[model samples]
Target: MIRAAKCSFCGGDVEPGTGIMFVKRDGTVLHFCSSKCRRSMLELKRKPVKVKWARKTREQAEAKVRRR
Candidate 1:
């Protein structure tokens, strides 16, 4: 049975139209409808994301101490 695929980037239904598949080390797979989306997805994986709690500054730490 042939199942329809979906695009990870734009959430569009993929119709076997020359798409690219990405596989991670943990066996996770992501499919993209075009090369453009695939390239962008790879770039996103290369960048590091900062945690919200880790973004606190020195002043914020001092204020928390004063409140306590």
Candidate 2:
């Protein structure tokens, strides 16, 4: 069984042959589920933790401690 790759920018599921893949100069591979994610990460330089639709944003928020 082939495993689906998750989008590097949004943490969304990317089915095989359906998304874009980028190889950086450092040899790190980045996968994106759509043009929005690709542009946000590569062109706009937006952080995943700051994107509302990104799963990492929620995860990062949950990881923080709430001090009263």
Candidate 3:
């Protein structure tokens, strides 16, 4: 079975057979669920926390850790 990837920018899931995969010169693999994520991380160089559309903020990450 194909595994789902987490978006490097928005922390969203990138389902198998969908989304974009980027490989940097240093061999770092980056996955994006949509063009918005790709552009935000690459072109616009924006942070996910600063983008409201992402909705995955630092607080959410802290909450997840607490829940776990």
Candidate 4:
């Protein structure tokens, strides 16, 4: 069984052969679930921390400590 890769931008599951793959000159591999994610990361230069819809953003928010 093959394991599906997660989107590098949104942290969503990326089924095999259904998403875009990108490789940087530094040998880093990136996978995106859709053109929106790819464009946001590559073209718009948006950070996942600032994207409200990204699962990664939500996870990071949930993981943060609430100091009073």
Candidate 5:
């Protein structure tokens, strides 16, 4: 998949003839049109996003008992 030269955050068109890249751990390549956008994305990646309700949680869970 070829990512266009656009800001991944803002989706703004990236200036042609001006871009940078880096190799990820998975051997995937990243293309950034500008330093600012790249920095923003890097910062975002550093933080762990919280996922709600991956399965069942106490907030929306119930207790059940079983007997033989």
Candidate 6:
């Protein structure tokens, strides 16, 4: 079953079979919708919340849902 992936850095939808999947030495799996997302995450080491252009992360969205 193909499932849509969420961008690890931008919280954007990554269509099945598209985007980049990065695996860290510690077994951390990160999905990036675009090279821009990948660069922001690994190279730049920027936080989604701290970046004004970044979208709200899945955790942030879930937190809002749980709070209500």
How badly does each model clash, as a count of residue pairs?
Answer: 0, 0, 0, 0, 0, 0
Predicted structure 3: lDDT: 0.89
lDDT of 5 by residue, 1-68 (tens): 55356444334565656677766899976666666556756755521122232112222333332221
For residues 32-63, what per-residue lDDT tens digits would candidate 1 score against the true structure? Answer: 77765566557754211222222123445568
Query: Per-residue lDDT for 3 in model 3?
Result: 99
**Every model's TM-score:** 0.55, 0.81, 0.80, 0.86, 0.42, 0.79
Q: In candidate 4, what are the lDDT values of residues 1-68, reduced to their tens digit? A: 77699999999999987999999999999999999999999999999999999999998888784431
- Mark the 10 consecutive residues where model 3 has the least summed lDDT: 52-61
Q: Count backbone clashes in candidate 1.
A: 0
Candidate 6, residue 42: the lDDT equals: 95
lDDT of 3 by residue, 1-68 (tens): 78999999988899999999999999999999999899989999898877777857865777889999
What TM-score would you give candidate 6 relative to the actual structure? 0.79
**Model 1 pairs whose backbones collide:** none
lDDT of candidate 2?
0.90
- Candidate with better TM-score, 3 vs 4: 4
The stretch of ten residues in a row with the least summed lDDT in candidate 1 is 46-55
List where candidate 4 sits over 4 angstroms from the true fold: 65-68
Model 4: which residue pairs collide?
none
Candidate 6 local lDDT, 1-68, one digit each (tens): 89998988888899998999999999999999999989998999888977766677556766899999
What clash pairs does model 5 have? none
| Model 2, runs deviating above 4 Å | 63-68
lDDT of 2 by residue, 1-68 (tens): 76799999988899987999999999999999999999999999999987898988887777774431
Would you list the C-alpha lDDT of every candidate in the order shown?
0.58, 0.90, 0.89, 0.93, 0.49, 0.88
Ranking of models by TM-score: 4, 2, 3, 6, 1, 5
